[model samples]
Target: MHLVVRPLSTVKSSLFYSTSSHVPARAMVYAQYGKPSEVLSRMPLYRIHKHTLPDVKPQDVHIRFLAAPINPADCNQVEGVYPIKPPFNTSLGSDEPVAVGGNEGVAEVIALGDQVKGFSVGDKVVMAQAGRGTWRSHAALPASEVQLLPGFNSQVSLVHAATLTAHPHINVDNVEHHIGDYVIQNGANSAVGQFVIQIAHAWGLKTINVVRDRPNLDELKEYLTSLGATHILTEEELSKRETRSKLKGWLDGRKLRLALNCVGGKNATELGRYLDHEGKHVTYGAMSKQPMAVPAAPLIFKDVSYHGFWVSRWTDTHSRQEREAMFGDLINLIKEGKLREPVWEKVSWKLNASEQENETAFKEAVNKGITGFGKGKQIVFFED
Candidate 1:
């Protein structure tokens, strides 16, 4: 059979590993989808695999898992609610075809295929595509799916390592906006939200940040302000008519050209309320678990538009080099300390632990992720 995905570049793996050895991976996988608590059990999650890497394919890279985050979307996927699903095939070395559960993580390259290039042993890599199953202890993938983080000065936090794959922020210029155009977004405290702030700021874009009122509201506001946010407001304030007037007056006739909405329901409509003519509202997440409703006024009178973005679907259409280039820029920003990693709770996974123990900890992490906004992200790291 022919490979569906091709390597981004072709060259010899001489710069990488010399030994060809079998590499087994411990991964969390499920054959059928249902409520995560019910469908995601311990039986098959840790299983043997078919591609134990006795010999690496020409386009494959062997990777040792470092850290992987348990994202809410991942849990939703386990429940069979997420839109993009991983391919279930017998290749996972299971009794039947099953899909792995992780979407984002960091890894160390242990070996490379004969035709793989631009990577060496011990090099760090971040997931370049969603549904690549980073939950495993090891993985062998096509070079196109992983972006290399240089072994040199470009160091990143373990949290950043797992999250660099979550939302592949499109090149700002690729959006329907010009430089210095005003963009507004709610959930500015989210991993993706923080990234939007730094990315927009670094690329000469201005962002108006919005957040739900929290106990540490002042501190969170201060933190976002330091990241080059031009304006920040709470959800309560944004819902007010007077606040919109104030926002318009403060901008001095500059149109609020784009609104990034991660929280849906009324928050989404409110996000579209203050826009320049024909503004675009791109919704990437629905943390509120609410449906988006748009007022007819903006649609008929102002030509405001609503669209959805999912990073997993994006990888199917976009070039690997483009995704890697975006990753490179983000990595550079993190290395300089300009972009800060979000708060996260680290979960240690050990092979010696009873399967029941692993299941309980993972279940806890999943629940935390579902509820863990502003508090922190749930990250799983292996203990040596």
Candidate 2:
């Protein structure tokens, strides 16, 4: 791997407009861990930093980032809370050791190493796992760092390919349900929750989705139902004694075999109440930022098993071939129209734009993602 070293003069400028032919790249970088807004910089003023990139080596493939999402995990990672950490280094030409932001996105290969046989210059690929920075204009990475998107050339849109990694991978791993089994999930409107409904539908499993009530409660329920949700209930509805009776009626005696939780606290505990004996509860996120107050009755008497799923860990343990196969399956699902991309607001990065402008755009996107301002996911789309 080639190391990146920035000149002292470049560091003095608040805004970097690279005119050099040797190296040219920019990224949202941070040297210290703190609140993402406070710690992440775009220019010298905030936290965004510009840097030179090493030339593609015999084993490297040069790629330009097409788009990336501001996922909750990405924000958490920036806040120094996520379990997976990007290797902090001077690779971005920072005076101090720093790491780039973002963990998920799709990139287009623009140049290839002589020794890289499998990947061609035009292939679209995604990171093999988390912690590899995707929030940048370009990268020169090992051929093994990314996997080709089989559906990208055909039916998959940049929006779909860019946002594919986290949600689908977790659902496939955490929920092991057969055709007839029923699964329940909280945060049904979230990206992963939506996937759980669609994937479960595609596989012939039933899903009872739970979400908090809003002013447009009926509209939200209708929307989720259209996504193949078997039933949609508010948190209050799920907690009702009568609601359990209604669920029993809905199940018609089939066991509720799996529960997927993104919201912790009372919501998570309530979600587990309806599980059948020997059912499994899989927690993938904690949007509520509260502990799961699971009752002991289900654990002791019903033999309920609790587990957590993190896609980063999943990708690390699985082989390259296995990850590619999973991607292929997801692409096939997209081709068949059984799977759909989540709603998203694009944060476009223009190559000609000033570094300050680009940084401001990303900061807004992150704030929107963190504050829950919009109805869709926030994705950054890079443009020339």
Candidate 3:
């Protein structure tokens, strides 16, 4: 099924429409890097006025956003800590240069240029590369800047498309894989870790998942187990000798070919301990904010290698065709029910509300996400 853009007449406010080629839009803008709550509050809720949507160039496509996720990296970027930064520019109608706050989301094409090809007015698409600000209601982007989700059908939910870019399944696909191979990972309950477990299971790989023990540890374990985790343990259990013995028996002399680490502390070291010769350990996040202590034994004796996988960097270096191919594959997985969207909560954006009201709602959600209050990922869903 395709997503059609709503007609201008149906929009609640004239703030969203234009008589000329330029389209009116709204965005969460930040002029300087600092705390998200503070920096984001410096400007009015709708910093981007009607003039921001410059006339769609020959290579440009106009789009209306469906949803965008507030990822940890997005916060870090707003705080001036992330490695990649969106170029601060006056494209958003600001007198001074500023950047939008989101990196991942799904949008429907509302208009296209004469020079563009292979994309219809209603096709659903995602950013082809990182740093095109996504925390906005509309944008006129170059055709090369967005990638179409060819397999995006009715079964592929909006939540999955919005969070797809930052999902950990890309790491699972990038790492070395073979049927029957054993994979180990920490943060099994994290958004990325959950996808890793499901994808590995679908690919015939055995996964040993480690998580921090919580009050409802048993329930969490059961949920992950149902997702096809071959084994589950806590950080404390991972350090125990008996636990290692049990894992050894389960391995039955088969070695762990890969380890996906998000927590970078003692637990990460333990994951490396199980790696087979020439095994690869991929680190994608450091939730603990601590350095990983790697012993030289595995590097020297077992020939194990360590790597850091950042989705932004991967997208920047890969070709559009290659990136779209991966997107198509994951969308198909969702269609087949082999993959599922992460737990997430939506913050609604009412088009009819006052700008201040909408801004307050958006900031409240970001603050909750930064404080880690919610049980699921927080996403902004635009309402017509």
Winning model by lDDT: 3
Q: Write the per-residue lDDT of candidate 2 for residues 122-181, one digit (tens) a residue.
A: 678998878999988888778788878765665788888998888546655654666778
Question: TM per model?
Answer: 0.87, 0.90, 0.91
- In the range 34-86, model 3's lDDT, one tens digit per residue, is 87766666764224333446666767788889999888888888888998787
Q: List the residue pairs that clash in candidate 2.
A: 41-46, 41-47, 41-48, 42-47, 42-48
- Which stretches of candidate 1 lie above 4 Å from their native place? 1-14, 40-53, 150-154, 170-180, 352-354
Model 2, residue 29: distance off in Å is: 1.0
**CA lDDT of each candidate?**
0.75, 0.80, 0.81
- Rank the candidate models, highest TM-score first: 3, 2, 1
Instruction: Give the Å error, residue 209, model 1.
Output: 2.0
| TM-score for predicted model 2 compared with the true structure | 0.90
Cα deviation at 53, candidate 3, in Å, is 2.2
